[model samples]
Target chain A: MSRFLSVLLHGFWKDLPPFRLVLGLCPALAVTASANNGLGMGMSVTFVLIFSNLVISLLRNVIPNKVRIASYIVIIATLVVIVEMILQAYFFGLSQQLGIYIPLIVVNCIILGRAEAFASRNTPFLSAVDGLSIGLGFTMSLTVVGSIREMLGAGTWFGMSLASAEFEPFAFMIKAPGAFICLGLLLGLMNAFSHWRGENVIQK
Target chain B: MDLVLLAISAIFVNNILLAQYLGNCPFCGVSKKLSTSLGMGAAVIFVATLASIFTWLVYYYLLEPLGLKYMQTLVFILIIASLVQFVEIFLKKFSKPLYNALGIYLPLITTNCAVMGIALLNIKHEFGFWEMVVFSISSAAGFTLAIILFASIRERLFISHVPSFMKGTAIALVTAGIMSLSFMGFSGMVN
Candidate 1:
């Protein structure tokens, strides 16, 4: 249906929260040392997010107003546990590399933000679609950032050498500071692109 | 013992804010004034230590044995959020000034990676019950030290003539880079 298509396309450009609003920068910066790591982390968050949105959407009216946030958090956390267990059991290497970040997803503002903003008000099917699209947008952003860092810092893409020893990697690119620089630049570039597009101007 | 090593490392070598980049949302957000940063750091120290303690117990006793270790992250997050809510309500009821100073920062604490990081690190190191307590305390202290120092820097930064492009987060991040580099000096102290 046209409604579903609108939701899916919105995630790519118009309604992309992270690219536009900059809500969840913790995992956006911390765990993005590699493409695989970013992808793995993103997919895990997507899984938790979609399930939580579905559940929250289903129980929206039944939940009491006073305890809604608490109830939402409980639902989100339960889903995180399920995805985390499966990832650890099957994708052990990623499970190890991601390390504490897997658990850190609970604090990722994107998931919680969506739960509060969209899912609580929408139907279950629509909520799931929003979760998937928005999650994919986040995943794309992480991958791009990770790819840039990995390529420049280590002269590799996804752990394979892309540049030779003749090139001296900017060691800072792999460090914590690099995360900020990369993210800031990325945000600026995204802003510049949107301006050039000259379609919809959300504030700077 | 390793506990002592962790304490030293956390304080000087691997501070959560300066080195590991945890708790940076508040670090950058609230570090404009020295006094406020100190207050925020103190609040974080109190909450992070307590949260770490409780999450560790939950992980070791409940989750690990029951083959539900994956649930640790989600459960830990819920625990921290609820704990902050509880702290906020209690403070509002008992003390006005305390609540006002810390009230806004309380909700933000739910996502301050340092709290979650301490819990995860406790699990990763397989720290015993007592060691978790020590690690959490030292880590919290280290976070306080880093933020307060950074706050002092920002106070100075306000007066300094910064470049056009590097005014806000750009300069703060560069300062952190320098801080991280300096902290690297302490690496030899551990080994």
Candidate 2:
């Protein structure tokens, strides 16, 4: 149980991307201006990550070594199509909002990165937990970024009005530039936090 | 003309790299130098335009008529993968200098989101054959422009005083944000 908890915690900070690693920011920045948008995108990605990790873990032995990347892509793309269809059917608006990012998930390095790095080598159960933990970390980062953008860019949270009428939003926060600024600041803050904690641990 | 608008929009207004955030991995990864960025940009122009033509034909002629539209993603990906392989071989044989310049980046073209995004956008907009060709070439040009410009910025950034935490991607993201803001000026120009 302690080992499982350690794995989950490792994903939170040790493997937290955008802040620590900066692996996948294509979808991370483009679709994270609003809370709902971030959550919608993150959950869909979670679905893809979990399913793909499980299947890849199971097929690690059966799949040939020579064409593994190609096989992995096929599996991932299949899941993306399924997720796309399901979103289109049930949540039309969110699907429309996500637009190309949803389909673009097929090429997201995070999913492929995890598949190659963790799942291919780990046991099925471990891979599943890793997916969940990493997915949650991704979701947490997105929500934080999205909330900051939403509050400052549009004076709203998930599109709900948050500020007084007199408050004029900084329109750039909602735009592409704002995505970069927020991400950069968050990364810097995360680094500072880690440094502070590191110093204390060393002293102890 | 609408064709001219499509060209302009792809280049400035709706840049595949900047506005749409497509092909970001290469935009960040291979953009450390200007000359290499230019090379990758040119290769992307060639591949994206060609892929658009091929995917468009495949979608309209083969998939649409055969009622295999649902298989479009699978088929398009296969086409792109094989096309990159062909491009790699052709470049190696004919233009060794260019091939050497591109190096391993050539194979990475298969996964460049801009290529797939443009192909998908062409379908989404239901662009005519000629329009599709124009859009693809122009989009590639836009990608080249943004990437080369970004490379120049990054080259300059190497010598600049960046804070410890914001050394690499942190600074890159900030730069991209500012560029995105600049690109926003082009939005109302087209639509």
Error of 2 at A130 (Å): 1.5
Candidate 2 local lDDT, residue B128: 95
Identify the runs in model 1 with alpha carbons over 4 angstroms from their true place.
Answer: A1-6, A14-19, A192-204, B65-67, B152-178
Q: How does model 2 score on DockQ?
A: 0.44
TM-score of chain B of each: 0.94, 0.96
**For model 1, how does the per-residue alpha-carbon lDDT over B1-191 read when each residue is reduced to its tens digit?**
57788789888887777666677767777888898888888888889988988888888789889998766777788789888989999999999999988887888888788888888888888888888888888888998888888889888998999644445665665676677667767879986
lDDT of 1 by residue, A110-136 (tens): 888898999999999999999999888
> Compared with the true structure, what per-residue lDDT tens digits does model 2 show for residues A1-204?
897898677667888864664566778788988988888888888888888898999999989888888888898888888888899899999999998788878877888889999889988888888888888888888888888999999999988899999999998888877887788777767766767777321100
Q: What is the TM-score of chain A in candidate 2?
A: 0.95
> Whose lDDT is greatest here?
2
Docking class of predicted structure 1: acceptable
